[model samples]
Target: MKGNTNKIIWLTGASSGIGEALAYELSHKGYKLIISARNEKQLILVKEKCKYPENVAVLPLDLAGFSTVGNGVKIAIAIYGRIDILINNAGISQRSLIMETGLEVYEKLIIVNYLGTVALTKEVLPHFISKKSGQFVTVTSLMGKFGSPYRSGYCAAKHALHGFFDVLRMEHDKDGIDVTLVCPGFVQTKVAINALIGDGSSQNRNDTATEQGMPAEIFARKMIRAIEQKKYEVYIGGKEIKGIYLKRFFPNLLHKIVLRSQYR
Candidate 1:
């Protein structure tokens, strides 16, 4: 399976961080890729850095622009004839208290992280159903399973993703569609620096935990292995991954631990 080069993947948020890392890894494995993000230049740069640049195509996509997703999907399909997998990795993080966060901020979070992903998935669903074999690998966050301070809107958006994708898997498994929800904890990326603040502006700073988290390359390797294995769900991170179990078995303890940590 690792040697199969015919598989084509459409990966969103391919310009940076985990998406960028995933692009490089997939290219190394000889998968044809159509990479997308709002930043065309960054996407091109990422594609150029891949091991097999010839196997990569760039498609600039803005998840917030839901109306354009149909056209985008058409363009993506034109590049590869069919998309074997759709990686929903483009999303924004937040670093604001709920009370201070504006309604607009929450709306943008929902649009980009939840609704936009849903829109893209819906656009691709028909094609996947027609093919009777396709994968939806969504990159959510550990926050999706539990809560944290200063990430109220972000958590809510990620939480919604879990709900939507879970149902998608249940509804489409008969069609041979697979859904893998990858919930990542902090990684050494610009996510913290680029996170949205209370007024919808970028946070413009890094969080301590994020700076000290696992490197993107390492995280991508583990994630790719999970994808190759076709796991239904995988949580990748440091000790933070344990939060999933904590949330399940000891909600109060998890709350106390999260409150004490006060991560931003």
Candidate 2:
């Protein structure tokens, strides 16, 4: 699907941050887009800002509420006849230690970050299988590759995404199904401010590293290139991208460095 301007892309979490930037970029490239988020109003605002506002459709979705996902998928397909790509970008972050976090917090994390994405994917899987061509671009985090402080549940959910999508690529390669796992280290966004804390409430604060990380627009550009190339996976960020290699070849050293780092 590289260089295909007619492709239809359904992007979640399009109301803000990286997703918003991606919507703008993709729409500018002449691709039809269906932007989704829990807030329909914000989704509309984002659509208006796109290069081709008339080509952008807003579909509000609640990832935590999986029961409505099937119908949502149906509506998404109807919007553009079929979706060429599904960008799984909707997920919540965590900013609490495991010891103090509530069970419900972890449950919400898994539901929104893992189960919700899986449910949506399952709903769309049959269509892909029928057509024998589709793409799933999941916006996981660098935490998916390794650990970090104040993000135990977030890390677990992201790591789960890697596992699930990896197997998906393996099982559906023959069907022409493509899975691209995008791991982002730190992007200047509201993710940290919206992160859940021990009491199941938003952290409501910005993170130092996140504020200083790469711009969401820049990350979006790189991410789209990777998607166009149909890469199996790609990591986007500043120096923090090195953590992936550090974890792979120097586990103990990475662990020590993580403990001493101030990013959390």
Taken over the whole model, the C-alpha lDDT of each candidate is 0.94, 0.94
Model 2 lDDT per residue over 1-264, tens place: 235567999999999999999999998888899999999999999999998899899999998888999999999999989999999999999998889999999999999999999999999999999999999999999999999999999999999999999999999999999999999989999999999999999999999999999999999999999999999999999999989999999999999998999467
Query: With candidate 2 superimposed using the best TM-score fit, by how many Å does residue 184's alpha carbon deviate from the native?
Result: 0.3
Candidate 1 regions with alpha-carbon error over 4 angstroms = none
Let me know the TM-score candidate 2 reaches against the reference structure. 0.98
Q: Write the per-residue lDDT of candidate 1 for residues 1-264, one digit (tens) a residue.
A: 268588999999999999999999899988899999999999999988999999999999999998899999999999979999999999999999889999999999999999999999999999999989999999999999999999998899999999999999999999999999999998999999999999889999999999999999999999989988999999999999999999999999999999999975
TM-score of predicted structure 1: 0.98
What lDDT does model 2 reach?
A: 0.94
